[model samples]
Target chain A: MGDYFVLAISSIFINNILLAQYLGNCPFLGTSKKMETAVGMGMAVIFVLVMAGIITWITNTFFLVKFDLEYLRTVVFILVIASLVQFVEMFLKKSIPALYAGLGIFLPLITTNCAVMGVCLILVNEEYNFMQALVASFCYAVGFALALILFAGVRERILLARVPTPLQDTSIALVTAGILSLTFFAFKGMV
Target chain B: MAKSLTQEFVKGLWDEVPPFRLVLGLCPTLAVTKAVENGIGMGVATTFVLVFSNILISSMRNVIPSKVRIASFIVIIATFVTIAELLMQAYTYPLFKKLGIFIPLIVVNCIILGRAEAFASKRGVFRSFLDGLGIGIGFTLSLVALAAVRELLGTGSLTFWVKPIQILGPSFKPFSFMVEAPGAFVALGLMLCIMNLAGRK
Candidate 1:
């Protein structure tokens, strides 16, 4: 449907999880040192966020909502994410060693990465149904991936730019993030 | 043993601080720190969960296998986060509603889990407690500072319990952006720069 495309575009630029919502910024500022690593991390995050959203949606709608144990949502969701990350790591390692080699380190890190969990929370809060949740997760993951890659590219450029020692690493990253966030603010008018 | 325990405890406050120094827990630090009150509330709640969970995890570290340590640590941390959520609801209903989902989202807060795996799992119970306390206080202090600057700049008047605590009163107008998202980044970035400069000195 046109609605799904709209959702994807809008979420990716306008309602961006990092620049707009300020979620999952740890990787944005921390892991964006190199473009290749950023690309790898972004793809890894995309897979994790979509899978997390889907699994959490199913778990919430069927188990938490039906059983009236909605209070356990946080506990259950975290456990699921951790296990899911583990499963993915093993699966990728066995099936596609090259892909695994690229994403392997980031996989363990993604388990605790707030972005994956944050997307699931957003889907639940937005009250997206199973199908909508899937679409939203896919869009949101892509958005996060896009933001990561963009920042990584910028940071790679930044590395060559003669910078002061004090503002070298995290400070420069934060300033860059602030600028990106301001740019993303322009998307507020789109939706 | 004792000196290292002190080192672990002190590190969280300054050297290994969650938000400002280490930049670990960015989500809550930026999101909930719109106001001084919210920041303090979130900081204390997170500290409670972090300290307690660190204690429990450190004590049980020997039993949990290396292969499944991370999963077990998360479950343990989640249990405490749940308890903290319930306590917040029971005692501070108004604050609970204000905090909303962030309370539960504490389950995934990297600071707590990072401490569990990095320090607590390898340390003894008493030292873990001390480390947790130090880190928790440090996190709380940073949140309070960020919230204070944001609240003072954004609101024109800081408030607690619906009463305005005036610093400059009606004579001063607030810069609303300080209460917004970009303001969080600007203020934190500036503060980080200042702090790093001071540390170098």
Candidate 2:
């Protein structure tokens, strides 16, 4: 139990998926301009990533390792994620309209979102068992959401400030993200 | 198609560089560029995927159903990525370890997919190949440039292969931060800002 707790805290804080591990940053910047989209993207990521982590872990343990098809893990994992995103989208649309409306636009984007793939790959690489993978995936997804929401709040404010023309959009945003990452780096000592 | 073949290739070097102009593949741009060798290795690996996937997709552009085109494209890209991963493991194990998971992450690198969807799917085979080559080089240059700044400033030395060569005076203190995670974001951000300023002229 304590190990799980530590893993959760470490994944969420010390090694944040977006700020530290540097995964899933495209969406981190792309969808983070607005608080609404950031929140939506966060929710969608948590949904998709947790599912992907579990599914990929199972697949790796049972199928890939069982048959010595481990070399195909990369191709298999990507295919699973792409198809999983599609499957989730279809399932949500059919049984849960309200939820689908909330997450619909973000689902397809998650297919290519490296955070999802990264987490799945990490789960297998770290050799985390089913239970640990669940805990870590959820925490990492939460961490990604945490960073995105905070960054979105800051970005909304930065829009009001006067900035140089060249550094206006992504330039300033990245520098801001750098500072944000520094703050996250502080968490390293705590771990 | 007013642009000449050379122009198509040249544009990616400056006009449409993947990381800077298109901002397509930011994940790898920020992650693996702690050193120059890793940067070049990654850039070459991505270039392989980009060139081949573009060739395959462009050649089969007419046959793939539009509805499932993205899936097919992904499969094609994933195959090349796997091949790249294995090749690196076999021949460049050191780089493979340095790059680690990122080598596989190339499948999601947006730049490759962006080119495929926007350029290759609609273009001739040779043109798609050129587009891929151009973008790949552009992406490579961007990584090398970013890695150069970080490695030079942070460590006061640049690495070639495995050895670090001291490039600065012995008295120089390494800025160090430029090579850290936060530094990557800051360095890339500032570089983009500088590039914009330079391009303004």
Candidate 3:
């Protein structure tokens, strides 16, 4: 139990997926401009990340490892993720129409987002068991959502504040993201 | 045709520089840049993948159906990425380990896909080759520049290879913060700001 707690806190706070691990930052900056979009992206990521994490783990253990096709991990994992994302989009649209309406557009984007792929790779590297992988994946996605939402809030406000002409859009967003990442460091030693 | 190819090549140096100007491939840009050596390793690895994938995809552009072109491009990119990974492990094991996940994650890098779809698919093989080379070098330059700033401030030294060459004397206390996770963002942010300022004038 204590070990699980540590993993949760560490993944969500200390070694956050976005701030600390530097995964999934492309969407971190792009979708973070508006709060709704950030929220949408975050939900889509958490939903997909948890499933991908579990699915990839099983694939690696039973399929890749069994065949000693470890060299093809990159190619295999990507294909798995791409197909999974496609499947999820179709299912969401068919069964969960309302929910799909919200997360539909963001779904395709998650296919390419590095956070999902990065976390899956980490899951393999860490050699975590099934339960641990599940927990870690969920927490990491939560961490991504938390950071994205927080950054979105700050960015929305920064839009109004008077700033230099040159540092208008992406330049300023990056600077703010840096400060946000700095604040996350406070979570260190908490676990 | 010759002038245009040169123009295409030179454009990636400044006009469409992968990280700075194009603003694609931020994942690797932020991660794996803690050391100058890491930056070079990453840049070279990415360049290898980019140049080859562009050439292959460009040549096979017509055969790839438009509907599945993105998928085709990804498969092609992933194949090269795997090749790059194996080559790195065979030659530069330490740097390979340093760049671990980010190396495979390169398959999803926006810059590679962006160039594949935007430039390579529509252009000639030679033109795509030039485009990839130019952009790859631009990406390496950006990585090295960012890595230098972080490593220098974070450690008071620059590491081109295994050894750290101390540029700032013994008395200097490393800013340390610049090399940490947060420091990558801050350094890149400040650098982007500086780029903007320079571009304006």
Top candidate by DockQ: 2
Best to worst by DockQ, what's the order?
2, 3, 1
| Pairs with backbone N, CA or C atoms under 3 Å apart (clashes), candidate 1 | none
Model 1 has an lDDT value of: 0.85
Reference-based lDDT, residue B199, model 2 = 93
User: What do the candidate models score in CA lDDT, each in turn?
Assistant: 0.85, 0.94, 0.93
Local accuracy of candidate 3 as per-residue lDDT tens digits, A76-186: 999999999999999999999999989999998997899999999999999999999999999999999999999999999998899888777888888888889889988
The candidate 3 chain B region of ten consecutive residues with least summed lDDT is B1-10
Deviating ranges (above 4 Å) for candidate 1:
B1-8, B160-164
| Alpha carbon lDDT at B32, candidate 3 | 84
lDDT of 3 at B59: 100
Model 3, B49-166: lDDT tens per residue? 9999999999999999999888888899999999999998998898888898999999999999999999899999999999999999999999999999999989999999989999
Residue lDDT tens for model 1, A45-98: 988888889999999989999999988888998889988998999999999999
Write one digit per residue (lDDT tens) for candidate 1, span B47-157. 999899999999999999998888888899899989988898999898888877778878778899888988899988999999999999999999888888888999876
Better of 1 and 3 by DockQ: 3
